[model samples]
Target: MRDAIKQLAESRSECTTRQTWYSALFSYNYPNSSETLRTVLDLLITARNEKTTQLQDTGLDPAVRARLQDEVSPLIHAHLPDPIVSEKGAIGIKAESVYQFYECDAGRAAVVFVSEILTAVTTELTHTGSIGYPLTTVLASAVGVHSRFLQASKKQVLDDLPI
Candidate 1:
């Protein structure tokens, strides 16, 4: 978890998406609001604990790990005007939806991605003096990665829950 967090933050420093504008999932605000950051940290910690315990209890096989890396980690998207779910945005993903999704394999993978983002943000802040990195810079990273993970399972996770 520590290594993943550090590596994620380092990778974002080179994010090309900064050339264009973007925001975190369910948020229009740049960087992240304190409340939102808090929420992200909470989610990250929970995911860390969960995944850690999971691996400890049931070590992953090489094939299973490879499958997760291939199917669950990559960002796949439909090219066009964009998916209907994305055409219309929301203030944030419903917590209930995330909770339900947490029980599934895809959901767990998504959680790992989101956790990476929060971990990166936290790491950057640690070196930003007192004020920390600009919110814009924080959110400016390539939008499609972590957000994709969160969005990938949105319909299945959220189900009939309102956006």
Candidate 2:
């Protein structure tokens, strides 16, 4: 169980292996399944909230953060448009969605955005041995990506959830 949880955090681990681990958690038919699953879920939720707060408190101005997030929406929308119902009735994205996300225009933009950021970081590191790349340059690249999305038809945002 410990190893399985560790696998979830390893980027290079095979998706099938991760899926198997998730399945095991759900398939455990022991009397303690309910308590165990609840504990695991609470831990996951707490960790997520902490990370989100960290990101939200980053020194970037709120406007800059919002602009960057808007640029990233396309990739997120493509990747998570579908829901997967798991063995224990948990809803989530399939690991395979990672591959599918890179196939569309938004995904392509994400690739370019990532490449721009990586290039900026690498160049900065090679020249100064520091990660103090300028925020303006990153935001500029994001704006360029956002312009491309603007030319595409906008997706309607639903104001209300279906009952």
Highest TM-score: which candidate?
Answer: 2
Tens digits of lDDT, candidate 1, 1-163? 2233323433433455624211233222222222333344345545544544554435688776565444322121110001111112212222322312121232243354354356445445544544535753455344445556655444342323211
Total colliding residue pairs, candidate 1: 1
What TM value does model 1 have?
0.25
lDDT (C-alpha, whole model) for all candidates: 0.35, 0.35
Clashing pairs in 1: 31-135
Clashes of each: 1, 0
After superposition, which runs of candidate 1 have C-alpha atoms over 4 Å from their true positions?
A: 1-7, 10-28, 65-163
TM-score of 2: 0.26
The CA lDDT at 30 in model 1 is 23
Candidate 2 lDDT tens digits, 1-163 = 3234333333223333422222211122221222343344345445544444555766978886676554333222222222222223222222342211111233233333343344444444546544445764564566566646633522222121110
- Each model's TM-score? 0.25, 0.26
